[model samples]
Target: MTFKAAKEFNTPVGNYCYYHISRETYPIGITQIKEGNSVYIMATPEKALCDLIANQPGINLRYKKEALEFLEENLRFDMDKFCQFNPEIFLAYAKNGKKSTSILTILKLLQHE
Candidate 1:
């Protein structure tokens, strides 16, 4: 899934897919992964978590406890790896969204732990 500046058309199918279009730099969070002859650029776990929360429309993360619960239970993120996550790309993606604060809050919590 390549990042495009403009939104593209996708036919409805049983499988769900998302294409993030932005005027800013693309793949704000990504790493290259190779499997056999194929090479793919995909979001790191940190970016994936950020995108998931950011893309949601009206999720509430105002409370630290609730936010932590969501991350641990709903998202099932590995807290251990979170300490190694880089926020640069997630920040870029979250810059325009209301969820940026929540993302930062989570990151801050993870870092302090």
Candidate 2:
């Protein structure tokens, strides 16, 4: 997955592009998968969420309730799958990435779930 600016553009194939800036914002917990003759590398869901929070401007998830609302209402993130996310990834990202408050709140939300 790509992490650059928070702008999205429609591709010819109708897929939306989401990206971010800065090397520090690059995702963690990446994995590579091979299918047939092709290989693809992508970030884990935890890292992707962190990257989204850090790079997407105008988002304000300062409190746990706000973070939860953002996840449930704005992103419609599946709470059932929330249990599978690695809290360590969010912790690591909060230590060195932008949006520390929002990231930490997300981690706190995970812990209480």
Candidate 3:
């Protein structure tokens, strides 16, 4: 299997919904929302990411299901375009060692891309 020494996905267990990525050599796991965006990562350098979204004092807004679909369709792993903006995530995967480590987004695992 190409995913023999695969990576692990670090996401919230339930109510907490921030899918954070940290330093860990996992066999296989899911990090990003297997469905949407509005990634709710923790501001700290921790492995656990959760979505802490709430209405502001005056503004009342929420990430709708459609918005998530939009993100997945348009922004999901469009690294060719999005990397210019935030390159760290991509860099992390690139800097990964060839034999020692491998990073594959859940999408790739789906299509075996």
Q: Which tens-of-lDDT digit does each residue in 23-47 have in candidate 2? A: 6556466778899999988888898
Better of 1 and 3 by TM-score: 1
Per-model C-alpha RMSD: 3.6, 2.7, 16.0
Q: Which candidate is the best by TM-score?
A: 2
Model 2 pairs in collision = 3-20, 4-19, 4-20, 4-21, 5-20
Query: Residue 79 of model 3: what lDDT?
Result: 32
Better candidate number, 1 or 2, judged by TM-score? 2
TM-score of 3: 0.20
Models sorted by TM-score, best on top: 2, 1, 3
lDDT of 1 by residue, 85-104 (tens): 77666567667544777887
Question: lDDT, candidate 1, residue 93?
Answer: 61
Quality of model 3 by C-alpha lDDT: 0.28
Which number leads on lDDT?
2
- lDDT per residue for candidate 3 within 1-113, as digits (tens), equals 12244344555763432233224322122244333646632232111111111111221223334333433564353434322333233224434422111122322222224
